[model samples]
Target: MVELAGEILNLPIPPHDEVLPYSESCTDKSVHDLNADNVVLCRAGDDNQLGIILEIQREKDKRKRFSWPA
Candidate 1:
């Protein structure tokens, strides 16, 4: 996975000790809840290394521009 991401991003991604499925929800008390299609958590040892969020959009949605950043 890291190899694929590094190739696509053109940036070196360090090796992670573990990769796990994460919650799809992103919620803030001051803002509306945002849900993604999938979320991945990358960990190195006991610390969190990176978080990957995946949102699958089959059709164009103008609202995605605003919601994606949240």
Candidate 2:
């Protein structure tokens, strides 16, 4: 797993999805909730803004679950 520091953004923000590329191991969420922190976890490709990375998935076996927004 790769770690990075950056903000979280949605579509029509940066319009770049090549920064982080894709994961063949498992699916990834475009935007993740930080819950109590108010922050979010997103792929470098999906993020438009730039923030700092607080944490990352240390376990390679942990396949991230992704879903379509409602």
Candidate 3:
């Protein structure tokens, strides 16, 4: 798993300034509580404007391919 994780980490990383600070993993438990790998949020200060969730796959999983779109 380390190799797989390392491979992912080797990818180009974007600067924090380019992305809003609101972007983070899904951790809220009150509402829908699904631990998302990473979530990109477009926001201005405290206001959350939009979100684009990205799920990581270390290996091939047929279910993930279909579920990721949801």
Candidate 4:
């Protein structure tokens, strides 16, 4: 796992009309601050969702090799 400090990064989803209660272990700010093993936790409807970045794909795009929690 790699971390990027003081840089802009994107999450899996774009901003939405109604965003549920969500927590990303690695936030845009966290990425900018350079945190590792990023995980996002959120609620939608009646479900719990997570977006996890297992690895970084590219430094150029800061492309994240990520997955959803099960």
- TM-score, candidate 3, is 0.41
The numbered model that scores best in lDDT is: 1
In candidate 1, which residue ranges exceed 4 Å CA deviation? Answer: 1-5
Please write out the lDDT profile of model 2 over residues 1-70, one tens digit for every residue.
1222322432233333333322222223756433221233334555544322233445654344332211
Model 4 lDDT on a 0 to 1 scale: 0.37
Model 3, span 1-70: residue lDDT tens: 3234336667433222234434444434466556566656555566555455556789998878786453
Candidate 3 whole-model C-alpha lDDT, 0 to 1: 0.52
How many clashing pairs per prediction, in order?
A: 0, 4, 0, 2
Could you give candidate 1's per-residue lDDT for residues 1-70 as a string of tens digits? 5556668779666678988999998788788888888888888999888787777779888987777876
Minimal lDDT window, size 10, model 3: 12-21
Q: Order of candidates by TM-score, top first?
A: 1, 3, 4, 2
- Full candidate order by lDDT, most accurate first: 1, 3, 4, 2
Candidate that would win on TM-score: 1
lDDT for model 2, please. Answer: 0.33
Model 4 RMSD vs true structure: 11.6
Count clashing pairs, candidate 2: 4
Selected candidate, larger TM-score, 2 vs 3: 3
| lDDT of every model, 2 decimals | 0.79, 0.33, 0.52, 0.37
